[model samples]
Target chain A: MPEAVPDQFQGFAVDKKENWNRPKLTSYDRKPINAHDVVLKNETCGLCYSDIHTVQANWSPIARDNLVVGHEIVGKVIAVGDKVTEFKIGDRVGIGAASSSCRECNRCKSDNEQYCKTQAATYNSKDVRSDGYVTQGGYSSHSIADELFCFKIPDDLPSKYASPLMCAGITVFSPLIRNLGGADAKGKNVGIIGIGGLGHLALQFANAMGANVVAFSRSSSKKQQALELGAHEFIATGEDKDWAEKYDDYFDLILNCASGVDGLNLEEYLSVLKVDKKFVSVGLPPVEEKFEVSPFTFLKQGASFGSSLLGSKAEVQQMLDIAAKHNVKPMIEEIPISEENCAKALDRCEAGDVRYRFVFTDFDKAFTA
Target chain B: MPEAVPDQFQGFAVDKKENWNRPKLTSYDRKPINAHDVVLKNETCGLCYSDIHTVQANWSPIARDNLVVGHEIVGKVIAVGDKVTEFKIGDRVGIGAASSSCRECNRCKSDNEQYCKTQAATYNSKDVRSDGYVTQGGYSSHSIADELFCFKIPDDLPSKYASPLMCAGITVFSPLIRNLGGADAKGKNVGIIGIGGLGHLALQFANAMGANVVAFSRSSSKKQQALELGAHEFIATGEDKDWAEKYDDYFDLILNCASGVDGLNLEEYLSVLKVDKKFVSVGLPPVEEKFEVSPFTFLKQGASFGSSLLGSKAEVQQMLDIAAKHNVKPMIEEIPISEENCAKALDRCEAGDVRYRFVFTDFDKAFTA
Candidate 1:
């Protein structure tokens, strides 16, 4: 039998923009469960760059006073609404950046719910089904989401390891699978720019997909790590002054996974893509950050510039299955869920101090101990 | 039997950037015929926007003192080099923007020679096989080019019609066929943004490809003409403020054939593309012009922005065959080939005064009448 549900859920919330990093432990009212809703007892949640961006108001001004930001959520279903057929009371599941979408739209019906016009973000976005209820994220004791957005965790995958895959993994995986001929991407040259949370996983996914994976970072510091993580070659872009020239027209697909675009030379990166290929960015810098390229630049190599949002629930499940099969796991540091740790994790992530990712664990201890 | 080849080619050449529109009749030396070279007695040449840009130095300063700047050349082969096997002495042929490319390169071998590093333009660009011989374009009595670059015009297609198809037709057709599931693009919502030379041809090609074609122009003036040119619907973007909203997530493919990006709301156009679709540009504005879009803009709908150069040799042939098969003819105005008419054509094209395209004919009258 599942544990009794709480009327209010507790989590670390940023009450003010000025004190964004220093989140405080607080309780917030949960939305009334809908027919397709499933309530999860939060076990682990990944610390994504998006979380830091949200709290810091880099994308937009903090819309809600008690905005709780965490989307790479992994937990157990404690409750399932009457019409929730996908999940039972104790199913292990995960939810990524998206919480819900109007299921009737063409995009939603076509497995592109992540880009639905009325799609709601996992946190700080208004729940269309509820009145004045802004959706809370998984940086909490419990998370209630439409069962359609929740993906079942593969039994072989650990909850902690599966956390970051919810967002970072699928963000990279979808574009790779879509562009690189899916499961058999053999002999294709794939480049992963900025080996951070997403790039590292992109390297692994591209490699597992049988592509000739190349990892590009600012320096040589992550060279060994990138190779160990599945890159066939490593390019220290900052160290090599002639990297772009040397690798001109090299990549079949390049995934830009850098968290920021400061000092990013988009043209130099674009110069290395083969004709009729694409450079897809899954790591968003800021809402205001624009990618500028001369039309001649794209014309020269017949290249394209595009970005993908988080993958659909179907893609998310496929990603988890692929991850489990290929042993694709994010290098993560486990942190006990607490107000101080959450603040520290955000600070460290903002500072680019984390090796790859951070996952909040010890949820029961943080909430009840 | 074919007529004897002339020692020199005569054409209207732009001697000064300041007097770009006032082209003067001049004689220039042609590159010595190579094994793969073919010489043609020019009959009709299309005045493309590129001709105006080249003479006016909009793309770059005139590198040559006398730049003969027309690429859409259609003529009968008068001379064939020793190794030219594709055509005999009297074959009717057409040559578009590209004149020659290093045939050994992967791009060249793979039918993407238009993007080869050493690809030579039909005019102004340096002939890689020759020493300091700048290629002079058509608008001439006779033209010389690599036979590989010379495509046999379909017997059913008139020389005047085939002239614009060389450059303008293939520019739009390549991208359409490449993106829209070539040969049969039925039921796809395809938008041709701009109803000028390139845009006009794009409409016919997209329609011929069996797409649900929509024409987007600045005003309703071209509504009747656009509808007649195979557009199922015509949208005056300037007249309708809510067109973007109304057609949000609508197009399967959008070909931006607008010659200039002045007041072009890229975001608004991008907003209408369905998820994972592309907005491709075949029109060339000035070289310095840059396309800027926020990452979030592309992320929202999973749309891509890309541009294409002139089509490959294979694509050009395919385009011509398709045009011939479907009667995809460009609406053209015929002008007699002369220094005065060439100047007038350039001035008119620069002012956007031409209806769709201008094809210069009566080559013999201009040179030897």
Candidate 2:
């Protein structure tokens, strides 16, 4: 073990449920590194909507008193356990929403570990493989993850840009690649709803994959920006009353990337899909929120409704490779890692004020204690 | 026009909505034959669960007084319009649920006329292209449909067996062929829910498509029958408490051919699907019923929920060809077509007295009035 690796790690965490937005600087302990574990000194971490949702306890009550929520971690390897062959000291890598899964399951063996029943999230989750320790995330000075979930950061991609791709990038990239025939996606019509953090990256990836991308947003405010981000067409759903009529049966694949589901007209979005196509939602609303559709709506076009979580470890590697190959960069606002800055970023993210994503940097300065 | 073609077709009609179950024999006018019209002398028709649902006003109120309700029609073409090239006089033909569609639309041009907005049902639907005449279905002396919506019965297929294939057959066949890679479905794991009208045919078609078929029924009573009808395995869902646990992530494609949705645990059915696989429903429950699932259920395996209507003309012809090639035959009970016999068949069908399906035959004797 490296002498520089701290016994106690520092991070911004939420201590009180009511004061969720006001994260406080705090110290936490990491689990003992196992044979397959690699310790990462986080260089940058992306502020995701899930981070806010976790602190606010929207999905579930905080499982731990001090919940350090951040999963899109881009860092350099500081130490590796005996059996860790995938990463060595000084290797740049990234970790997304999931940190570990029961590797013995068929799903894990088949490159679908994200759907494994015993999979552990990067933060505020119990690591059953490691003595039931509550896992902390990349907001801390160090993050320890099984080598299976850690992805090598491409040399062409910088840490700040790669941070958001760890979460937002994989969320959209997995579906597009899987559904749109991977490299054979040329000339396919892809519709992306919402032009925020996830949607913005979806546009870049879909375009880079050679799909004709269309951006769907509530207003025309993001039309120019969406186009700049690689969308060939834009549909302002709020302004266009006849949008459904105009684009009826137009899209080959429509991905719902909106952050929330309130007032979402799912039938209208479904109406635009071609026969036998799919409408997959990646942006999750609150856990209580549900999507309802008449059976006839699906029957009308033989269409399907589906959703996806974070990508598999293999898919995460592929996503990073594609990002590097296409030079795909997320529009990120960099914030110095501090208790006050973390609180401000959470507030802005909740308000949808950020232009795109927020990546926290200066981890060394913030964690110095 | 031939001398055999009647100026007015006679059928069993439901006059009053309250007395929907008791239909009376009545005569009705046929739309003036257009360029693409094919007039058929009715021979046999399948009594589908949809027939009972329609006649009993389960889907909608009796659209018109004396509405005739039947769709799976098989007969000999007695007359053809000037532009009808697909069928000639005395050619055997069949018409499923759809009677006609706006042939100029993209959906129609692409062989998906069943999904066209202007598509007309065979029974109690207004034909927009034919002076808005109410269309009567196969429980009649004769029937008329556009050549585009009519298909030629294969030489080797008999009318009694081919009747159900028109509606019940295409309804299940389209989804299987579309989702399971058509002829390339060899060795794929396919699950069929329910063992009644649609399901029985689904089992045969999926098996003939070379899939490893599994049948799911409420009780063990149908286990032997399901196996005999080409299922490699049978699951008695009502008796098996751990069915979902036993078959988790087991299926590549699952078709919900169950007649009703009374106590369907969709999450359980979804749990058995492999990651990125589909659960498609061809059965139409009451219009008021909706399938609800939490978004997490779909995220768990990237599984999809979808539904399909009756197939297109091309797909119907392909289904018939496959039936002929594979010697696929539906299990059916024959009933003579009469006001009394029709009512009896509907009653028996509602009570689940029939083994699988009922085909109304002896049309010449029953419609002689």
Candidate 3:
């Protein structure tokens, strides 16, 4: 490891101005590790729709200024604070969407810090520190986070495959494990309603958990991909005539990963849910698309529909353990970190060029001096 | 019991021309009970919104001319079949919304008879016998039901109070009990939307089950009645400004009892449900109403929205046991059973004039020779 900070520590820094549409590699300072923090030399940082949303300022209430936009962080812990006990220097660790939370709250105490009242996102979120540094993310050579928010990656899990799992995997995995009576039970019919990032990972996890995995996608192109990803069945909603009838009261649980509410009629989904079944959502999109479901759907079937945020550190660890045990690997494309290449990768991700996920390899980069 | 059939057993038959209006009840010979059948002599039969819908003579693809329309049945078993073990002569048993189901199916085996493939409702339903008899309900003097559908009324529970438990009571009870993690766990804040029959009973059951019960009604007039029925709080949607915001995320479960697709906004209700909480509906009005809710309401908070049907025989027994133990009783009005008053009861029920439930007595007047 280099003793001195590089003249140009490789990082993709985005200027949120309209004219500045691309990310650039630059020299980034690493704060001396705090007593309760660890500095990760980013081996892989997964690119996400959220990152594109943050970079392009597409989503409402988006960051208005400079922001580094990667949260699916995975790498070795190069340095740790004196107070940190769970992690040490050279230990492999990962961070998901959250960077910090009020540890005193009930949610934090229960290892559900993602839902904490004073939660901080990995990027574009105001830091809770007295020094008031805004939280930056893992589109860089290195990133630092509190020990509580860091997860030790399993030795067998590849850093490339594990990167997207930090965000996309945990986003879907948390709900499946939590809602289906936790990580123990099996033989449940778990439906994944999308064949994208969250949906693919959800299919893998549900299949790994001994559930009958059903993948639902709008396009038939994903049918082969879904089946190859351990989906017991693939449903192309756009192609089927009266598909809801065939699958009515079919799933024990349904995880909807589609960002649009119009993709699936909630009433039809609710009908597919048997008595006491749950339909959970993890995607955050616009609200104007109307979702019309009747009270009878809820009343007659005893079904439920809800959503899940990114998982906590504990859930992420559990997900990693499950991934390792099942030898589950997300199909990913790793890209070299640089200004021009990073912009291209982001553009490709925006155009849905990658099979599943894109990870930025910032450690060995041209900008590192 | 009467030694012989009365000579006037054929009196006041269903008009063949207006047979679509109501089923023929005069042919009820009060036949010898089958092994799995329970012969209940009607004492008080409650009027349900569904009962009126069945005979409205409008909507029909499945509608038959000779349809019987009553499900909230409270009466004494005059006799039991030889193979029956659960009940005998003189045992008070009540029949609810459903009467028979294919016990061999998964839903039936799991005790979720309402979802059974070959399920038969108490009224306007076809019996599963080889020579299928059009199943008649409690609007007549006598009701014969499968033993599995018959519930033993608690010794201390009033006939009128226990009557609605078979239908309206169980409708809300199923969602409340299941969503709250049953009666023995940590009690939660429960909201009963709509202060009609089902909502009133839901308030009672929710309160009895140790939950903090809140009643939601369109008019302020139901405030006192709601509180009297064990609601700790009342929210008149028409009267309360920003009520959804004032109590946002306050409830662990919201049981929606309104039967229409109109005037119900699920997004506003979802705001009041806590993380992992449920917004359930049980009222099945004819048309399918669309709920306008953004996926974010569920995804971010991990909250759920869904429906529940009437519970199983086991669940019904559990509810009855809890009701008996808690002395939970619904407010009800009793009326005399006569041909002249049937239309009045149906009209009054439709107009929402009764306190909560209306029970019919004077069976002898309707069936006398």
Estimated TM-score per prediction?
0.98, 0.96, 0.86
User: In candidate 1, what are the lDDT values of residues B192-250, reduced to their tens digit?
Assistant: 99999999999999998899999998899999999999999999998999889889888
lDDT of 2 by residue, B1-369 (tens): 555667788998888667666778899887778889999998999988887878777787777768888898999998988999889998999999988888888999998889887888998788858876888888888899999889899877899999999999999999898888776689799999999999999999999999999999989999999998899999998899898898887899999998777688888888889899999988888887877666677888899999888988889888888888888899999998887888888888989899888899998887763
Best of the two (1, 3) by TM-score? 1
Candidate 3 per-residue lDDT, tens place, B1-369, comes to 633323222222233334433334455443335568877777778888887666763323334434456788888877666767898788889999887776676788788878775777776567764245666778776777888899998888878777888898888887787778877534588888888888888888898888888899887988998898889898888888789878854788888887664777666777677667777777766653466676665654577777777888998998888888877777778887665566667768878788788887777767753
* Candidate 1 chain B worst ten-residue window by lDDT: B288-297
Q: Candidate 2 clash total?
A: 0
Tens digit of per-residue lDDT, candidate 1, span A24-83: 888888878887888999999999999888887888877776888899999999998888
Pairs with steric clashes in candidate 1: none
Instruction: Using lDDT, rank the candidates from best to worst.
Output: 1, 2, 3
Model 3 residue B54 lDDT score: 64
Where is model 1 more than 4 Å wrong at Cα?
none
Docking class of predicted structure 1: medium
Chain A TM-score vs. truth, each candidate: 0.97, 0.97, 0.92
Clashes of 1: 0
lDDT of 2: 0.87
Model 3, position B97, has a per-residue lDDT of 82
